[model samples]
Target: MSEKEIYQRVEEWLSRMTLEQKIGQMIQTERMSITPEEVKVFHIGSVLSGGGSSPGENKPADWVKMNDAFWAASVEEDEKHLPIPILYGVDAIHGHNNVLGATIFPHNIGLGCANDPELVKKIAQSTAREILATGVEWTFAPTLAVARNNQWGRTYESYSEDPEIVKSYAGAFVEGLQGDLKTDSVIACVKHWVGDGGTTYGIDQGDTDISEAELRKIHIPPYIPAIQAGTLTVMASFNSWKGDKLHGHKYLLTDVLKEELGFKGFIISDWDGCDYLNADFHQTVAQGVNAGIDLFMVSEKWKPFGESLNQHVNSGNVKPERIDDAVRRILYVKIKYGLFEKPRPSARYWSNHESFGGSAHREVAREAVRKSLVLLKNENDLLPLKRDARIIVAGKNANDRGHQCGGFTVAWQGVSDSMDEESDEPASKITTAYGADAGVQRGKIIGGTSIWEGIKAMSPKAELNINGNMADRSRHDVGIVVIGETPYAEGMGDIRQGDETIAEMATKIKGLMKVLHPYGHSLVLNELHPEDLEAIKNITNQRIPAVVVLLSGRTLIIEKELEESTAFVAAWLPGSEGQGVADLLFGVYDFKGKLSFSWQKKAGENFRKGDEPYNPLFAFGYGLSYSNNTEN
Candidate 1:
């Protein structure tokens, strides 16, 4: 339809929709947080799986079935006269991430390393197909934050450190999400409107203290491409620009992004972002509404927010025209997605089927996992492991499913037995993502062994040993200690703040050094942060020539360690591949992968909180190996 025709229909719908319903259209919720009864009662606009949020019967096919049930019940016989289908949402940040079997593409930071926008687009399009199968139409993805710090919990979610890279990929991802926004494409949200990844110290939802010119230069470029690509929505970040919270920044939200940037989609806020307002709940609602937030993600308490907003409209605090504006935007999106008429009927959704995590999608996921691997350091030709070598493997994360998957897996920000699956081929692990959880078994590398088990498997000649305690006998050839911050969610309650986690981790590394110092055997440490090299040497500063192996998500600050260590390996989020790591350690698989995100220079937390220029310990895509040490 023509733009005018679309506008006329949206306006007509807004005029007809009740204040409650119109406000409902502006809110979204989680299934657990709300109920079908509540869906009926509140007449909520949409629902989503925040982070790892999913239903109990969360298999991909079952997800389709369950969603259809909710849609059938919620959309049937509605006296409130709401829109047709209730848009379902998810954090399909990578390859329908929450859906167990769908292709879990590498995080955006890794994609940024690929530096290929076409790849980004293809991944998103693959994700769109899987998402559509499950009856989900809206995905909150392609978070185009120009990441300034790797310390940020969500840093891996961002596309680039440069705005240009993010813009090209963000637009590509939008195209992938909607398969061309001009058609009946899924909605796209180019988010955090101002600066999210630019926060100092990598803090989540923190502040950006740059000038207006710098902000526009560094952070605003990505949104331009996303808007031009015809993204359907924009989610305001919980961060701040200059000194004002992005949610409350009128100029950035209304004037610049909507007016100046020429973006036509509606604007959404992060989860309960409106709660950050200075006033009481009601006043907070009014302030956020006045500031130009279109969708609140108000959740179950949407009634209170909607009611307060309605009061604002009635009392002249929030212009009625603004309310109409928000509703019009919402209607425009629903129409664009064909939700206005098609309504994503329950029957079209496959409640149970063979195609959940089928072979087609798995091939893409395998490619993603492989390319995402970054080869940080390889020394003395110690990589791409040989077919046969007396190898010793050790570490807590080795062979652990929870560590392989990292955060936002099946559970919310913690550990779990998630990645135990057979390596049949490069097939999609749908049963895991989309829930064929019945067949999951203890992950085995077939004839190969885990670092601990591998040691025992190839004992005597191989002499593999793994334990938390130091080795009493120094007969072994080398020492390898795998340690770092354990899993944590949100405020990081699992990992003790300060040096407790880092200190213990460092101590454990030093202990290994002391044990193997006499032999002068090479030392390998998993999750070795670059900043710890000095401290490690200061622990003894002599003997036990070492190799630091990083085995965590995102990149790290690796400086002194780069020079001090004989070998360094960046096993980029290797899942069920501890044996694969051991293979590389024993010179089996060469360290083929290079750094995805930039590394910072040697420094102590160069976050741009005060006057710092956000100095990184290393540059992005910087990795060195003994075999292939040439820089990419």
Candidate 2:
């Protein structure tokens, strides 16, 4: 049948159903508590596995069964909605980072480093395959944030402060995901519209204090390219634009984004954002409807949103036309994805080994990890360390898989240690980073060392010392002290404040670096804070060459370090790849990555919870290297 006719069929079918049935179709729940029976009873529309949410049996084959279970229930409920399927969604930011064995490409920040639109496209395509394997057909990704301040806990989430770069990259991601969106290709959702990354104080969902013109320039470019690519969905920003809330700003939501740009897809709000109208969530349902939000990521509280919406309609606070408009847009997106004709199957059984996280994808994922590594500083050819030099690896961050994986891996924020708390709980899923399993171990191979075994199989007549305490030192040619902030998400990251709580622990690094000082040893400072510079400044000024490496998801203000350090590096979070750091430090790899976002300046006197300035210490896309490149 023609597309429009099928849409009509679904809409007609929906019209015949009860309000409970329609609401059920609009509802999407977390994979937890979701079953085929729930779908048949609730007539649910969609399902998702939020960042760390996974199934009891996480194997690829098992995932297919779980997804099929949800699909089976929804289909069996009505059997009237056309051949289209129920849309499934995932946060496939930088490949399918959430799923184990799937290729985890560079984060958007790292993608910014490559600065290649084509590379971005390929990464998205790789991400789509894994997403499809789990039986999901929608992806909430290609975050279109033109981040301004590096201090924003989510700095790593933005590709750049410059709009041009964000836009170019966004287009590439959309094309890759929807290039030929078949049953295999997942639909892309361009997100957090307008000024999400411009929050004044970098609060997660705080205000963005800026003029309209500035907002348009510094923060809105990515969406333009996203629109051109026919991205299936656009999640509204939790942050506001200028002084008005985005969730309630009719001007930007309806007038500008819809009327001006002509976005054809549905507009989904950030989680729980619809309840944030006028800063009073309890009554936001009516306000959001009047503001033009199409589909809200509402949960059990959805009935409140619906009830408030109903009240607004009764009170004439929201016109019926607006309700119809929102529902039509929602219906439009469902139809566009061919959800009406081939509605997702509801059988909890499958046989596709190719689906879900697998081997071929890991090869592609490793390339992203390698290329995204940026070498910020190199003196006396310190990097690509001498294969023969004795190397001592220190710090809690050196070899723990849990810390190495970074945040948003198998849980929100992240666990402190690698050992699974409960095997019964789903194992934390992540792209295998570092070591032999992921090629990040190239450096470890050169050094003939493995943190787990404390030495290599080859022996090489070498003693490899792994020290959690810096003071308990072993004489070495080079001391690679791995340091960095532990994992946390946006709001939690801000709460942690510089992520230097490891200070009590870092006394060990300070003590050990000093004890090893007399040996002319070079220290590899991995992902450390700039404030900690004072601790090492005296040595640095004495020209005691030290290489500082950053293993953060965001950039830090490091003017003092740049001025006094031997060298500095930005190692964007390489998931489960401690070996990547080893490879680069031991000379197995070259410093090839550039800065993804601007290096933040210390929040000065003007810094507040929601105020942002235009300038920063280091510009976006900044990186240095001792590569063999001559000026063309």
Candidate 3:
């Protein structure tokens, strides 16, 4: 519809909504905290499932039923007179990541290495289809974070350190997700608004202590294309810009984003975002509304939030016009997406469809994994292993799908299917976590293939051993040690933030570096499990060639390990689809990925493109093809 038509519908809807209903439109609650009945009584505007939050069944049909309940309540109309369908959103960042059987794609960092904007758009389109199948309407994705610091926990969420790459691909992802704002597409939210990527010392939600000009130059450029692509919403950053929290930054949120950038859609607060404003709840609401946050993702605190917002509006502390403007934007987005026309979840085209985790989606994820694999080192042509060669896949990650998928799998931290219980055998020695024994068809594999299984499929006689002994290695022609960081999201993944001077911090870093020094680059000690170095040493000690398949969210200081090992490949958390890794390993596909982030030369040494003493182990865009370049 045209702007005039959309605005006219928005105005007509706004005219009928009561003050309480208008205020309700601004509050979003987590599904666990509020019910369908509460959604009707409170006239709650929207609902979200935080990471790890799902219905008891945790299936696509269950997700649809759960969302349908909230949708049913929001549009009931008996309580508040007029009905505005609730906008449901999820962190479908890499895929519809929350669903167990959904096809999991490479995270943004892996896609960044692919450097194909069109491919990235296709991935988003794939994600939208899976999300739509489950009846979800919005995705908090296409994270435009230009991660400058490798130490940042959320670095994997960024497309690149270069804003140019981020700028180039942001709109494609947005377009892919919100394709013409049709029923099959979910609204794309270009996220964490301004400078979440430029955080000081790579701390999560830390200050982006840069000048406005620098922020504009480095961080804000990506959003321009994303906005131009017709994204229906932009999520405010949890990080601060120039010492002011973005959730309440009036100039940036309202004047700059809305006025200067000409962003027509609504702005959303991060989860419990307004709580950071100040101790006074009333003042926080006033400032957030005045600063132009159309929707407050209060999660569980919507009750008090709604009450406070109403009091602020009635007392004239917050102008009703601000409320009207916020409501107008909310209704505008709802109408533009045709949510009013197709309010019920089950009525949507893809709703209750059995196509959630189809083979086609998995094939695309496999392709992403195949394209994103960076062959950092290949000595004596150790890769593309002879199909008949006896192989021993060692290390915890060799057969662990949960570790391969990383965080944001079935659970908040992720769950693993343990093919190798203690009673299973020597090959399955590594233990899996969480839902290892869930009665899913493939156990915890959940439409995923482990690297060990992928390897076995090609080389049926290959041996599987987590910590292979000398006898095992002596019998095998080649040993592939798949080892890297364990699953973690947000804060858990960050290496010591600059301010962490705690005794435990010092002890842990020292212990980690001590265990990791043998592998090379210990000073920039990553959160490497103790078994990683042991596995590599166990394999390399023998005469057999050792190929290290390193899985991580970002570069680790692995200069020594790379030298000691016959070959190394950097697989940045290739989600599910272990066949992709196996495909390249066994010569079914060639390596095509290049480095998206710069690899640090040594520990305690990290630099972006512009930094001085700019030595790196491997520069960005560095990679090796299977047919050529066999040197280190």
Please say which candidate is ahead in lDDT: 2 or 3.
3
lDDT of 1 by residue, 11-71 (tens): 7777677777777777786666776666656667777776645665456666776677667
Model 2, range 345-423, lDDT digits (tens) per residue?
3222213446444555544544555667776656666665555655444434444444544565545454444322233
Please, what is the whole-model Cα lDDT of each candidate in the order they appear? 0.58, 0.57, 0.80
lDDT of 1 at 135: 74
The candidate that achieves the highest TM-score relative to the unseen native structure: 3
Model 2 stretches with alpha carbons more than 4 Å out = 1-20, 33-35, 77-85, 278-282, 307-317, 340-352, 417-475, 495-547, 558-567, 577-583, 586-589, 600-621, 628-632
Query: What RMSD, rounded to one decimal, does every model reach?
Result: 9.1, 9.6, 5.2
The best candidate in terms of lDDT: 3
Model 3 weakest 10-residue run by lDDT: 510-519
Error of 3 at 251 (Å): 1.1
User: What's model 2's lDDT at 373?
Assistant: 70
Residue 322 of model 3, lDDT score: 95
Q: Which stretches of candidate 3 lie over 4 Å from their true place?
A: 421-442, 470-474, 497-527, 630-632
> Would you estimate the TM-scores of all the predictions?
0.78, 0.78, 0.92
By summed lDDT, the worst window of 10 consecutive residues in model 2 runs over: 512-521
How close to the true structure is residue 228 of candidate 2, measured as C-alpha lDDT?
82
